[model samples]
Target: MPVPSISTKKLIPSIAGKLALAGGSLVFGSWVLSDIVHLPGGGAGLLALGAGVWWVTRPSKPASFSEPSSLPGWIRRCEAVLAQFSELELSLGLDGLRSSREQELDRLKALHEPLSVGVVVSEGGTHPTTSELQIALEGVHSLELCIAKPLPVVADAWSWPQELEELDVILYGLPMPLRAADLLRLEQLPTDRPAWLLIRDSVHQSREARQEALSCQLPKQWCDRLLFWSGESADLRQGLLPVRSHFVQPSRSREITKQRLLTSLHRRWQAELEQLRRERFRSLLQRSQWIVAGVVIASPVPSVDLLAVAVVNGLMVKDMAQIWGCSWSSEVLQVVARQLGTAALGQGVVEWSGQALLGMAKLDGGTWLAAGLIQGLSAAYLTRVVGASMADWMALNAGVAEPDLEDLKRQAPLLVAKAAERERLDLPGFADQAKEWLKSQRYAGA
Candidate 1:
């Protein structure tokens, strides 16, 4: 089971912080207005507070996913993802995959050849060694055994080759008293195939010691499939069952391996596609935030500012949905965006941004220009938070036919917090960008 990107324990605190910020912003902004513009403090405060509530809770019209321009880089990347999926399905024996050009297809067909197993030996000691395992498997037919050591580590991680097309099931050996380095290495191995960790124990080792060794931390996936082995021929033979099962019925075994491979391939490819989409989204997010900032600066009315930001964020959500291959209608995407956006507002993303802007005012000196900049940056940061949370939600639910908007509403605050935490790590970068944007605006005015 996949763990959610954001945890529930932190969700409450995050939402509370946002609400506090929102309330604080309303009170403070209204006070500042009353003091500076000479209006009755209470009336200004109440008006601002009311306006804030109305804008945030107001229902809006649905927006659609925008069509891509002529082969934009993102479109090309999306096409690449589709192509990878098509090839994977074709390799898994799916029919009706029409290629545009009448090119050759032998390479794709060759991927379905007879099953091959690889025995990966750890560097150190092991009972019923590779030679012994080979002797135990003397009579097994139709299985090509490839013997190899774990790939050498480069820069503290396993350096995998471009393709592992030849091997299907990898029987990885692990000596007793599993080292952290070995576990780290295991983590880097390709998950797109059946991998079994063979824990080797000495025949002379005590049962207590063996139990202690077995108690070592292992991931849940590896824990169930763990094979305990000693030097005895019976132990080795029994331990080999999982690996041998792959070759039991050569044809049936082939299909099973292909199916397993396909499932893992889908997961790996989804991650790859998401990573690519994330890179593209950075630009989209930056652009949306700047636009939101500009609008907020031009017209600082709370409702109008939020509405403009919402429109920009709606378009962003549609593009993200399309990027993640979501088939949901624009209405569905907008519901998701609204859910996350509301959470962002409730959690005080805008308030936090306003506070940070005010903090900068200590050095920059107080002015209405600074106030506009503050609101603009707040809206921009709110967009960033909402966009990030939406991206997280869509990525987790990418392949699901129907995503539950209620579940998103429940998870929205935690997701926003998690995204905010990550985005804040790049605060200096954002600050620098804001500076450059401000400078550019000044130059444009001149």
Candidate 2:
């Protein structure tokens, strides 16, 4: 199975092309067509001029990759891995920042919309990540960002002021060993609204924060609703405890390995899908295309039990009928196709199918049931007749498992008679061929 790599390469140059074509056409036409068309060389020259003009007038390609930005080697590696896996960035250091510290702040600025910001900064321990904090606080619906910035690092945690002001949201990014004193200070703070507290460390640290709150004399809202988040550097398993979690590509080898494993699994999925297509669902694809192309054959020998579903998206079904082989009947086919997920199909099926089909060819599947039916019906005509290997692979591969022959028998009761007739006549491929011919030929006097 081919794993579809994230594409960083741009396919086309946008504009500046139209202008070139327009100019080329005028130049070629006037230069070659000087002589009258009534003469021989005149006509030839006219056509030649027109050709030259069009060629020269054609648009010139545009430049790519805008400019060269010096990115750190580690940063480049991070970008590559993040592109493979959806990554979230944390932003820290707001006092040093002039405006919203987003990567694309300028792009957002052009909208000229009033920004909604949530700032929670304190002078304390472990500083927040600049990228991660900014990204987490960004809310598209409210067009606001709720950031937490602590004050200068100080040994005395309780030295901070009692009631702060202008805080849309409160975020705490202190160290792992949280003390009971931290909760007392938080309670003293002015805001009764929601407060986002950072709780890094492992399982032990999370338990400490919950314990600290429980021991305090704070109100029910403060004790019960206080949000505890594992700090940015904490492990993922540790971080999942918080009600809301943000994921960023870790700048480490272990995280990169995890991303690659995910990619491999994705590829294996595609390989299985493709194997099913070649083995049993190819006919369904061809038939679906015929329907879309609106062509009907001379006779309807086998019924196409297709079920059409209207989804929010239409691009999901490009040669998707292969899914029907998962279970026979157009109805089953359509359902599975829709279930494949629109997110997966955005990158094109053939490429993904090859990736998924690579290893799946080795796996045992019910898809052969459909192909077996096809072969069984085709056997009626021999001597330059159709053939199918429904049960032949396990015959040679030795390692292949025989499906419950009883279950295969139970799948399609009516098709059994058609298959037996073809098998007795020694032309097992007839069923598929007959269907194909039926779809391809047009009825003359319908």
Index of the highest-lDDT prediction:
1
lDDT tens digits, residue span 1-446, model 1: 23235456744467778789878977777777777777676656667677889899754422222333322333343445567556534433544433521121223223566567777655663435657777666556756667774554334555444445447677777765676666776777755457788776666877566655565677656755677777677778887887787576776666555444444433454565566667667888899888888878887775533564476556587777766667888778877887877777787777876776566543233332566777777788788878878888877776566787756776787888888887778766777777777777777878
Q: Residue 402 CA error for candidate 2 (Å)? A: 96
Off by over 4 Å in 2: 1-124, 137-139, 142-149, 152-164, 174-176, 179-184, 203-220, 230-446
Candidate 1 yields a Cα-based lDDT of 0.65
Model 2 Cα lDDT, one tens digit per residue, 87-191: 111111113222222232223223333233343444445534655555554333333444444554443655443233322334555344554555556656544
Q: Each model's C-alpha lDDT?
A: 0.65, 0.34
Q: What's each prediction's TM-score?
A: 0.65, 0.22
Q: Locate the minimum summed-lDDT window of 10 residues in model 1.
A: 100-109
CA RMSD, predictions in order:
13.8, 24.3
